[model samples]
Structures are given as structure tokens and as C-alpha cells.
Target: MNAHDRHPMTVPSEKRTAISSLWLWLGGALLVLGIFFRVYNLDYKVFWIDEANTVLRSLGYVSQDVTDTLLTGELFQAEDLQAFQQPSPDRGWDDTMTALRSSAEHTPLYFLLSRLWVQTVGSSIATWRMPAVFFSLLLLPAVFWWGWELFGSKLSAGLATVLVALSPLHVLYAQEARPYSLLALMTALSSATLLWTLRSPTWNRWLLYGFTIVVGLYSQLLFTLVAIAHALYILASELTIYKRFTPNLLRYLIVSLGCIVAFSPWLVLLVNNLAEVQRKTASLGDDRYSIGGLIDRWFRVLNQMLIDRELAGWNFLLLLLAIAALVYLWRQAPRHATWMLLLVGGVPFLALALPDLVLGGERSLRVRYLFPTVLALQLTLGYWFAATIPTKRIPQSIVQTILILFIGLQILSNTVNAQRLVWWNKSRPASTYFEPVSALVNTLPNPLILTESKVSDLLALSYWLRPDITLQAIPDVVTLEIPQGYDPIYLHNGTPETEATLQQQGIRLTPIYPVNDSVDPWLWQLEFPL
Candidate 1:
């Protein structure tokens, strides 16, 4: 009579058990759905330029190799491009390492693992993306561990697992042959380990944390921001709690230094190749967006973390929810946990975002660069929901209903994205046009593709084109020949200079695929001199 009556908010033990079971089942189901989406249309999407490069490096070839072999104004069969995509006896692991080193901005770990992955499994497009799928699947558990450690609540961990599992952006990257998913996995694991180490500064735990740091850096350079966040959290926590440097803090610094020493080889490589790295990554710093545009895109990306339908007003609502969650955490949670969350969530974002805002760059606009921020935000939201839903003030049913609606929206977004051959996340212009253009080209009786565009573009398209088609690289469009016997010839990704040269030669190009001036056409049909 007394215990239950006095605590009206305290649900009966059996009711709590039932609610917990329900959440566990829902989390399990969402996890299965996430896995299904990651592997569903693995080969359906356009293997865009970046993915093509991933495959190339995995096969122990670089962009320079493609240029040297295929882009010397030579005529090659569409099938020939597959050579660079396929692993060979001649291009061994050493060659793969060499190829990866050429692209100094790209860390070698993912590519090296990809080389091994393809060697074991055949180099099909789906197979190439499987590593990312594996990492993303692992990410669910990693995120779960992180949330559990941060909030010390099973419900919070379960909610975090469910949220990340259904994240459309994560699902999209999981299907790509890229390291972003690996980076997420590393970030989550490292974060969880950091929290675990803080709870008990055991030697083994510290060693484990150091390992995550090294692997995290290898996973992606952006992880440097994560490590910095960890260091800041350690320093701040020690100062606040002990009011002096503690042995635990000293251990963390030593472990971090060890990780830095372990990572020095790559550091040396990056430093030595600074100019090449800068040149390779110069596009990231392009003055592409105004401050307002960047802020709008940031909201859009945050919204995409869970729901990507782009419904009007959704972004602003999400921003408010995120703010409320952080405020709630700061007020309700322990100071150390709140501070850790803030540092983990805020540091990486400010590091990237400030550069873009003040110096003018698009670094923050790239969703992959902001993955740590996304994961931290998801965790924050999870903790807030877990803490709030069980309270007597807000009816549990109402909170559950809101969460269900959010999940429903994510499911809807995933359904729409799964059916698409290209999406906004595939930022390259050619990715949007490749599928339709390839379809049009395949329909012709005999087709020839001529381009003066980069060899990388041709390689990207080769994945979509039929082996029967012929591709001719016209280094100088003035030397282009209207090869006989091909009923129709298409110009692919023709440069402005190429178009001007063709115009001077009196060749008329009719826009074919896009059929609109809204975007510069990628495919054009040429009317040769009679």
C-alpha cells in the first residue's frame, strides 16, 4: 500500500520490465533493418568518382596510373577500365602501399584493409563496400557502449543504438566504399573507452584507450579532433575534481603521447607531402557557400542524421530539440558527464566550423567531416529521451509516441533513399547523371563515348557502361575522329575547351541526357561533318 502510493510516479516492477522488453525488441528490430539497408542496394548506386578511386587504390593503382595507361588519347574498350579496378598478381601489397602513399591526404589503413578484403572476396562493387558495412554494424554496438558508459542507463544505450541504426546518413555511407563508417566506429569505440578509463584508471584500460587513439587516427585524420577532445576532457575533469593534476590525468597524457609516437610515421609522411596534401584537399576549402548558406547546410546535415525528408521547418525544430537536450543534460546529469559530452560534442564541431565560418571554407559542409559531432548529438538526444520518458511529469505514452514518429520518419527516409540510384550525399555532379546517361548509351545499337574530361570520370562511368561500348580519350578534341561503324557517338563530360574546339571544327552538339539547361549537360550527341 505504502511504497506504491507514496511514489505515484514509480511504475510497478512488472510494468517497468515490460517497457524494457519492448524497447529491447524495438532496438533489435531497428538494428536488423539498418543491416538490411546497408547491404540492400550495394551495387545499385552509381560507383561515383570517389568510390572509383577507392577501388583503384584497393587494386594497387592510383590516379596517375590511370592517366598514364588509359588517358593518353588512346581508344580503350569499356571493359579495359575494369583492369584498374581488379586486383592483379603484379600489383601486390607493396604496390597497394605505394598507390596509397601517392595520395598523401588519404591515410593508408582503410585502403590497405580494402586490399586484403578484396583479395579474400572478389572485387565486385558490393564486395568492395562490405568492409564499410561491417564497420557500420560494429558501430551500433560501439555507440551502445558509449551511451551506456556516458549515461549509465541501459535505456539510454538502447535508444542510442536504435537512433544510429536508423540514421539515413550512416546508412548511406555504410553502402559506400569509403572509410567514413570506419571513422565512426573508431570514434564511438574511442569515446566509450575514454569514459571507461575515466571510471577506473586501470593499466589495461589505459592501454586499450591508447590503442583506440592510434587506430582512430589511422581511420581518419579528423580523429585528431576527437583525441584533442579527449585530452581536453581529461584536463578539465582533473582540474575540476581534484583541483590539481592527478595520477589518472598523468596516465592519460602519457598514453596520448605514446599514441602520438605510434602515429609518427604517418605524421612524418603527411608532413613531408604537405604540398601534395594541400593540392589534393584544396577543393575542400573552396569558397562555395556564404555564411548563411553554410549555416542552412549545417541544419540540413543535422536533420539528415535522423530524418532526411527535408520537410519544411524540421531543421529548426531539430535545432531546438538538440539545444534542449544539452541544457537538460547539463542541469540534470553529473558535472563530469555533462562536461565530457559538451567537449566531445562541441570541440570537433567548433574546430571545423570556425575555420569555415571565419576563414571561408566548406570543410564543415562535408557531412563525413562532422561525424563525431553527429554521434555525440545522437548520444545527447538519447540520454535526454531516456531520462525524460520515465518521469511522471511527461506522460510516458506521449514520449513513446513522439519517439515512434521520429523512427517512422527515419524509416520513410530510408525507404526513399534505398530506391534511389543517386542522392545529394553523392556530391559529385557526375554521380547524378551517370545512371541515366549510361542507360541511354546502352540503348543505342552501337555507341562510342568520347571525352576530354579527366580519366577518373571515364573510370567512374565505366562501371555503369556495357562492355560492348567503346571509349576514346581525346586529349585534344581537335584530334577527335568520328569513328565509323558506330551508329551514335556521345561526348561525355566535355570540357568547355573541348566544346569550343568542337565548335571551331563545326561539329554540333545536342544536349541529350539532362535535356535542360539547369545543369551543364554531361552527355551530348555530336553531329559530325557529313
Candidate 2:
């Protein structure tokens, strides 16, 4: 028989099915292991500053409908003030709420959904972090599906899923209250949809792409980087198919215009609040780094993002290898090269870093700026695992083994980091601090003169509690105004000028109730006769 007519010896159907099932089990096991590493004992750690803010705002949003309505009226102007409230308890319904409230700086969609979630699961660390965890979990399936469709190989799909599931960066955000994990999932979904749209190219598909892009962008501003990368890929893909660029250019413009129209509401707010936003950027305290500092900071951020911050040093050898792997892939194919340049490196690096220089070098640079770039790097690595498989020379098992080894190394490094860094900090989760502050509002009297430093905490608490108290931010030296019926109680932590000013205005300076220590004290419950 001719070569085309003859069929190679094949395993029985049941064996093939068993083999397929085994692979699925392996992928599921890897995913479970990844999630466990990220989520196990998650609440044992303390809340980072940003996490505290998110929890405080979230509580304010869900518990205080009116407060959320008011805050949304001005793009969350109460953000700083609201953060003054104490941390949430990380317990039941109230706890879930606080975590969500603290995280309200971004779009409302995720937090809004989180409100519903908290209503059900309650606000344990596991529950609060589950949304991001689940989203990261969704990414594994998405990577598998994308690989299968793009390369028509189940091996490639399974390998990619394993790589993504085992990635340290994916695990890091997966355990947080933030939206980066969701953003990564959305990117995968959008990419998958884009691939399907290319095959079919229907109007519905185009609209689906548009909607997905809008949702992704709304989820996080970093998604704009994802869109930029996709746009370049689409342009290049079209050039490949049509052997020309003009008609594709017009089509891209139409699709892009649609995205702009959909995203205009956010764009308008972003533009109008540019100045206020710049001030927020400055609060990060990273503007003065030299180019060397920037590079060092960039890699350090990447390290924290990929593995746990504690495990960062342990994985230095692997990080160097990962960098080399990226270089190798870029050299291998133009598609990989374009993606790394445009999507992974180009957009996030320029957008975050250039803003400091362009906005007059006033704002501080931050690690979060590299979020999109980090996602792109994860995707690049997945694609690289698919591309570098040696078909004839090396056994397929050997190829899979090598990719799995890389994942194993990353996980090992992260595990070591988690033991060292996360444990040592004994970080206080958002709930612990926020709930007490929220409680203090009920205990304290009206006409409360909250020091300016405490304004953010109080505003966050007031948004949730809405205790009929007169609120004023105590700047360096400011008079406290009391209404006719109520007496004014000055809340001071050794700011004599502030206290004297309040006293001159007929307010009493008394430290009746102090929870924490001197440097950063808690609410002062001074008596006020009605």
C-alpha cells in the first residue's frame, strides 16, 4: 500500500480515552496545586496598604448604599478620607464588605460582583480572594483552549495550561483582592474570541470582540495595553492573509472607533481628573530613581509579580533563564518577536515610565504599572513552550518533561519565598484594622474633630456607618467648627498647634480614647454633651 493509504498502528479507543483522561487529571492536579500555593493560609498574612484601602472602600460601597451613591458622584473623591477608618474583621458579611470597599479605586464592575459574592460566601480571606483565584483558575482552561485552536495539538494545549497554572506571577495576583488575575483571564478570553473571529469573521464576532475589549478595559485601565497588542497582532495577521494592508487598515479603524465609543465615559473622567490622578501617582514615592534604579526596580517588581516577594531571591537563577528564554523565542519567530516588542515590553513600559517624565517628572513610579507587561510575559512563555517542542529529534515526553521542570522550579522558588517573606511580616489583613475603625465611629460622639491624617480612615468608615457626626479634616492648623447644640471634641496626637487652634475655636482638646500607639494612633472618643 502507498504511504497515504497505509495507517500507522494505533492504540485501542479505550486506551486513547484513558490517556486523554490522564492528561486532564494531570492538568487539573497542577491547577489545584497552583491554587493551593496561592491561597493556602492567605488570611494568615496582614493586609498591604493598597489592600487595606480596597477593603475599606468595599465595605463603604456595599453596606452604605447612599454613601456609595455619593462617592461615585465624584469618582470616589472620598477615597483618601474613607481610608482613615480602621480595617475590616475579615469575617462575615461585614468583613466581605470592608474588603470590597477598600478596593473601590478601580471600576465598579468587579466590586459590584464582589458585593453579591460577599452577600453569599461571607468575607473570609478565602472568599474575598476567591474571585481572583477563580479567575486565575479560568485562565488555565483558556490557555489550553487557545493552544488547541491555534496549533491543533492537544499536547501543546496541555503544556500551555500547565505552564500558566504553574506560573508564580499568576499565583501572586490570584490570591489578592485586585483585578489583575481577572484582567489576565479576560485577555485570554479576548484572544480566543479574536482567533475564532478570524476563522469566521461574522458581525456578531466583531461585536463580541468589541464587547470583550470594553469589559476588559473597564476591568482595569491596564487592558488598554492588551488592546494595543491585539491591534498590532490583527494588523499583522491581516497583512498575512490579504497580502495587503489598506482594507485591513480601514477595518481596524472601524473596530477601534467602536471601542472608543464604548469606553468614552471612563475616558472623559480620566481626562477631566488628570490633575487629581497625577497627585495620586505621586503618592507612590518612586519618582526620583535613576535609569539604573528604574531597571533594578522593574526587575524587582517583576520578581514579586512572578513569585512571592519572599521567594524572589531564591528564584534568581530561574528568572535569568526565563529572560534568556524570552530572548530565544523572539529570535525564533517574527510573530513572537512582534508580540514581545509591542505587547509585552512596549505598551506597559512606555505608559508607566514615560508618564513620570512627561507629566513633568512629579509623579512616583510604581510596580503595579508593569501589570500588563507581566501578563504579556506569561502569555509569551506559554507560546514559547508550544513553539520550542522538538518533534522528531526529542521525544514528546522529554519536551513535556522539560516544560514541567520549569514550572516545578518556579513553584519551588515561590514556596520557599512564601515561607520566608509572608510569614515574617505577620501582615495584618484589611479586615483586622478596618473593622475596629468602623466600630470606633459608633463609640465616638458627634462634632468629632478627626485629625487630617485620620481623615481617610474616618471617611472610609463614615461611608459605611454614616453616623450622623460632623466630619472635618484637620490640616496642619485648622479651627474646629461645632454646631449650636453639640460640643466639639478635639482628636489630637500631640499636634499642639492643631489642638490649640481647635481650643481657640472653643473645641476641647482631650485624648479620652486612644487605641494604638503614638506614631499612628486610633480614633479618640472625646465626650460631647448635646
Candidate 3:
């Protein structure tokens, strides 16, 4: 054989294997760090307004009898009702539970699951919020899997996962009793699965993708933006990358069509209920923080969510690395990265931002909304870091040094944030009104009351105490005065000025309970003696 022909042109299997091992270790370390951060204080902030709503309704739904009674505004027993009518400054569980069961306004899916969870865990705030925590934890693995898929390197994927795990914005939502984190996990899985299904025509994968998309959509209406993004991404891919129409595209279309068909029922209900939902949503005032204000707030959000709070000074460092990664992959990744970025980030943001422009702002910059985009950005960045950087004209030592520095910064930032999470979770801030009202329910039977505050927590409390209550805004309850001969136990959460007005109407305002006395502004519960 000629000398030129005898020279080897392939990498040794051992070297390739070593490289694979290195990436695996990098990814694993990142995954562990991410999980630890997200899970540290998951139990803290257990019963925010939204969560209370979810928990209460879920509890009511778990027991068909309770759910029925709750829905009918007759969840309290006769004895509880009589006790609620007594002259005491306080009535127990009866009043609170009855009010909540009858008056809460939110969707039922998450709440129903919450009721089952509370039954299993005794309805403690920590226990009630555990489900959200668990689901939020799943996002790390999803991020890792997603990153690895796009970049074909565990190292790159792990880096993305680390970014997500340490984000302050993500932690904020993860700490709450909401479905945004679950929605994020579903989006990551659905998008990854859709990519795989497109490349390989497997019915099971296609089916799984469809299921994820449907569940995500049902979980939150905003997922319609995701569906729109995916549709656009597919169209772009077909026109640009694939070049010609293929059987796989048709299969994808059919599967997507099937998903749309499955989602029809919920879609119809959403359409029918649009007016009610819109009215409630529109009541929120037009309050814009200006373009500069929006940018500044979003910057802080991005910083906390994409980098560690403690190392925020080093955010610029991390940003440079991300920029380097993108620059490296620019030529090879223009199409795929652009499409993924547009789908995951560009579209939903525009959907959210556009309404703000026309109607001013209405509290729309939630971190979880950008979860899909952040992950995609990581994957695209990772691909750039791994594939393009190594092949560039830069020196080998310089490239190695840059990768090591970037990864090290990410690890340091994530570690600091994980520790922060532990501290935050253990520090549970006490609420003023809920505990007192909950205690009062123990004294009253059919304790029907209305509160100036939101209704979800009260409803959840009723579900826990098994009371027949109808809770609402005073105006709402007054508008529905039933001929059933019942007077409501009113609780005021407004300023002293409003309390004085209620007192003038012969309603007695009692001192706030000790549990939340320090925090309560309305230092009295309105007594309605039957």
C-alpha cells in the first residue's frame, strides 16, 4: 500500500470513548446541581392566593359529596350554621369553609389533584405544595434530555440544565402553587418528542408528542402560543431544511390534526367562557411600566432566572460565554437555531407583548412563560459551544480554557443559588387572616362568609374542614341574596375606613386573631348574629 494510503484518517475509539465519558460526567454533575437548587425550598410559600384556590377546589372535588355541597353553597352542617349565628366575636371552621366552598373562581384540574394530595398528606401547607415542587423538579431532567438531543453532547445539555436550575425567575414560580412549572416540563418534552417524531416516523412517539401538547394546552390557555409556534417551526423546517414535501411531514400533519381534534372539547368550553374570563381579566387596570421599565424588570428577571443571584456580578461573564457559543455556531446553526429560537422564544413573547402594547400592560412578564425559550437558547448555545468552537481557527489551549471557564462559572453560580433555595424554603412567612378564619370554622357549622380578599385560600380551608360555606366579595354575595334565609359572616380585609362603613351598618368588628394579628390590616371580623 502507498505511504499516503497507510496514514490513518480516523480518531481512535478509545479517545472517542473518553470524550463521551467526560461529557456524561459533566451532564450528570449539572443535573444533580440543578435538582438540588430547584427542590431546596419547594415547600416554602406554600399557600399563596392562587395556590389556596387550587388546593381548596381540588379538595372539594376529591369528595364527590363535598364537591356537590361546595358547588351548591351548602357545605356546612346545621349545627355549624347555628354556631355561626351566635353572638361570639368568632365562629369556627363552619363559617370559613362554607364561604370558600361556594365562592372560589378558578379552574378545577390542579385543585382536584391537590385535594387528593392533601388527603394523603394531611393538608399542611408544605404537603399541599409538594405536588408543584415535584413537578417543578421534573424540569431539570427535561432540560438535560432536551439539550442533549439538540446538541448531541451531555456537556452542552447539562450546562443548559444548570442555567435553568439556578434562574431566580424559575425559583419564584417553582415556589408557588401554580401549574407553570409543569407546563414548562410538558413543553420541553413535547418539543423534543416532536423533533424526534419528525425525523423518525414512529406512531408511539408521535402519539406521545400529541398527548403532551394536549395536556400542556389544557394546563394553561397560553399554550396556544406554543401550538402556534410549533406550527410555524414545522412549516419553516419543511420549506427550508427538508426541501420537498415528504411522507413524514404528512404523518406529522396527521398527528397534529389528531391532537387538535382531541383538544376540541376544552377549546369549545374556553370559547364559550371567554366573556366571563375576559371580564375578570380586563378589570385589571392599565398600568404600564414604560419600555425602559419593562426592559429593566425583564433584565433582572433574566439575570436571576438564567444566573445565580449571588454571582449576579458574574452575569456578564456568563453572557459573554453564551455569546461566544453563538458566534461559534453561527454558520452551521443559522437555520435550525433560528427556527427553534423563533418557536420557543420569539412567538410567545410577541403574543404576550403585543397585547401589552395595544392595551397597555396587565402583569404579563412571568418567567415560566419563557421557560421553553430559555431551554432552546441553551441548546442552541450548547451546539455552538461543542461543534463550532472546536473546529474554529482558534488555538486548542484557548478553546479548552474558554470552555472550562464557562462551565466553571455556571457551576459556581448554580451552587450558590442552590444554597439560597435551601434558606428560602425553610423560612415560611406567616399569613394573618387565614389561620384565624380557619380556627373560627371549628366553632361554627354552616359558616357562610364573604371576604374582601381573594377566595381561593378560604375555599381550600373549607375543603380541609368540610364546611358548607359561600365565600365571595360583599358585592357579589349581596347581589345573590337567596330567599333560603341565611345571613353571611362578613370579613373585611380593607382599610379602617372601609371597616368603619361596615360597622355603621351594625356589623361588629372584632380584634384580629393572634396567629396573623401582626400582619392583618383589617383588625376585625364582621359578626352577623342570626
List the candidates' TM-scores in order. Answer: 0.95, 0.65, 0.68
- Candidate 1 wrongly placed segments (more than 4 Å): 1-15
Cα-based RMSD of candidate 3? 9.3
Those runs of model 2 whose alpha carbons end farther than 4 Å from true positions after fitting are: 1-25, 55-105, 120-126, 149-151, 239-251, 284-286, 309-319, 331-345, 355-367, 386-405, 413-530
TM-score of 3: 0.68
Determine the C-alpha RMSD for candidate 1 after optimal superposition of all C-alphas. Answer: 4.0
Q: Please identify model 3 stretches exceeding 4 Å from their true place.
A: 1-27, 61-122, 242-245, 283-285, 308-329, 384-451, 457-492, 495-530
**Residue 168 in model 1: shift from native, Å?**
0.9
| Predicted model with the maximum lDDT | 1
Q: List model 2 lDDT by residue over 288-329, tens digit each.
A: 666665655556655655544444455565477567557754
Worst 10 residues of 1 by lDDT: 1-10
Please give the distance, in angstroms, between residue 501's alpha carbon in candidate 3 and its true position after superposition: 2.8
